[model samples]
Target: MGCSNNWCELYGSHTSLCGCFVAIVLHGNKYITNHKGQTKPTVLLDCLAQWGIEKIFCIIVDNATANTCALRKFQSSFSLLSNEAFVMDGEFMHIRCAAHITNLIVNDGLAEVDENVSTIRNAVGYVRSSTPRLRSFELWIDSGKLTRGNFPLDVKTRWNSTYLMLSKALEFRLAFDKMEAEDMLYNDYFMEFEGGAQDGGRGHDCYNPEESDGVE
Candidate 1:
């Protein structure tokens, strides 16, 4: 019986606490156990022992040092019990979270285009930061016959948010260009930004202007 445990946060009316949960799947049946603790190896071991789980095939967890240590300690303890349930000497016990790995890879890739992203983010922020600017942007959208929508600010910690911001920005590209031409404030800000970039020896547009124009 291979079982896995992971820590989760729980919120209550009065307080929040961290706890561990254990789950086992075999023959289409799943068993679960929950315990309160900091997800240390000893707490995990105690939880499993309380559940009378002597045979553990493996545990799947994120790539955390505490989880690795816990798995090692659990494997050692199981070995001492001479339990045959331990597979591959617990070599394949620790499974890293695939989603976490993907997020890391995506974030790393996004960093390559961070300058362009920051530019768009700043532009969106400027538009949405004030009621007057948002109303002006809406008027620009109407005049340009562009799609009516709001500019979304991206969350710095979320890659998907950046994606949404870029997607929406592309959809409203004409309106943004119209604002640059007609709105002195918007025009001055971009001009100053470009000047700063040039002075810093990074004289590049936030994104390729031609490419932005070509997007249908």
Candidate 2:
């Protein structure tokens, strides 16, 4: 852990315990492959020694198994102290950093309609299947009878951003419905869900601009 004149900090990087695949590199981040049972702490120890770090103050970890495994390995092997927040130390121990805890919560628990969600997601993929369809969607939007909501494509966007998908596709109800009538998803479950979703009588930010999105 490192320390500022007025504060102390600890730091370590951890990824998803579920292993969905990600490679993030912060200024001091070192890549490590972690698995269950054996060999990781030794490898991590070697890496730290190579980097000339003798002590770790905290290990920032999240829902991924590999990350959880790695953090435990580090804690057992070394004599580092435990703290839940960031500390300016050589290596600190902190589990479930703010962003990661939120991710874990979302991944583990969120009330949503799954089937309708998939229908909306696949629509974009379906559109990409044919350039003509894509072009038609574009044209539909240009005709002023449709509005496009944000379609987030980030990794975290997969399951968590269904609302965004609904808002986007649902906004252009006429265009989407017209397209639906002529194609594969004519009787889509999402169409029904969209039609009966939260009433828009009053302003609500369930789907809104400039709000922090949720993902698990």
Candidate 3:
């Protein structure tokens, strides 16, 4: 029986704690269940014990305080059982979630390139905010004879969305450059708002049309 605590907001109002349970094994069918309660160590242990899963070999969970405490208490109980059903010493039962670790690593690396990412994100937002700007961008694409593709806007909170936005924006770098040079409204908008309080004074100097071809 593997369990983990997940906190979620209901209807964007009330916050609730939920415990996710999963039966994992090398063979046979597996099932998952969810229980809502306090994420204390004793509560989690009681939930597992009620499921008749006493001979647990190991518990895989993220490196949370409650989970670590639960596992420490659970190890003592498992040691008391005389039957040799449990494998290993249960000392190294808790395994940190790999996906969480990878997210941490990727987010850390993203911090180094945040300024460049923000520049691209803001440029995309600028073009997408108005119908005339979007139309102007489409016209630039046609003028350049470039294959048309949708320009995806990204959610700031999600790193993968930012990556996709940058990837898609790179394909239309020429179009963006052309629009910046030829479209009067586009230039005026940037001059007025690019370094203003609305955009936190992030200037358009970072997105030079001349350097668009070499932007990474």
Candidate 4:
């Protein structure tokens, strides 16, 4: 459950410890069931019914195997909420969440590439290990480094800081160039990172999804 202001402290803490838990009963938190590949429709149905949500306007979901299974289960449960509605409103429709489908496609495509790119990535790591070694390369950068319209030896890496670093550097390029000339800007990890917090680019899973829910 996501919390308010003191969110950092509440994160990773037990649910009971949360001061307040927002319950988006329709399609918010996902409860992976104990039974494998067996998401029950009644889980959400019972919760929504208990919350007194009658007249059943709509339900939203993402594209996941478990989610779709739960949706089908929910559809059947909604139909059976009353025998009269079961026979009358037989064509009850479920609206799939578009944000979910895109996530699945992106996940599948990236997984395929990650397996192939592992070795090349490892080789790059072996080359950039020591701070002093990386510093020594700056001399060569003056002769062969690719530069922008301004000057050479312009290696801009995030190392997981926000893009603000690059933005700030662009803003004060003159000062930074002077610092580089004075033998500053010398962190090996800053030049290359494992795409972690210290490295700021989007390695994966930064986009919104498209599919609503998946089929059982």
lDDT of 2 by residue, 1-216 (tens): 111111223345522111121332212444434345344455555555664555555444445666667656666665443343223542435454556566556644443533334444556554555556566666656544222333332233333464455565555556665665665543342344455573222111132334324321
lDDT of 3 by residue, 1-216 (tens): 233443332434322223333332211222332222233444544554554444444455654565566656656665675454244554445666565566566667777767777776777787888766677677866544222246678776556666678767776677777776787765666456544544442224355556544334
Model 4 residue runs over 4 Å out of place are 1-32, 35-39, 83-92, 108-216
Query: Candidate 3: where are CA atoms >4 Å away?
Result: 1-51, 57-86, 130-135, 142-150, 155-157, 188-216
lDDT of 1 by residue, 1-216 (tens): 334434322233211112223444422343333222233455555655655655555555655566566667656765776656565555666666665566677778878777777777777776877877887888866544222244678777667777777777766667777887788887566556454463221112355656544222
lDDT by residue (tens digit), candidate 4, 1-216? 322211212223211111111222223454434322334455545545654443343344544566556656666666666654322253433445544465555445545544322322222232244445344543444434322322212122212122222232333334333433543333233345655534422211121223211110
Candidate 1: worst-modelled 10 consecutive residues by lDDT? 12-21
Candidate 2 Cα errors over 4 Å, as ranges? 1-34, 37-39, 80-92, 108-111, 143-164, 182-216
With candidate 2 superimposed using the best TM-score fit, by how many Å does residue 209's alpha carbon deviate from the native? 15
Clash count per candidate: 1, 30, 0, 21
Displacement of the residue 175 alpha carbon in candidate 3, Å: 1.6
Using TM-score as the measure, name the better of candidate 2 and candidate 3. Answer: 3
Candidate scoring better on lDDT of 1 and 2: 1
TM agreement with the true structure for every prediction: 0.59, 0.54, 0.55, 0.37
Compared with the true structure, the alpha-carbon lDDT of candidate 3 equals 0.55
Candidate 3's displacement at residue 186, Å, is: 3.6
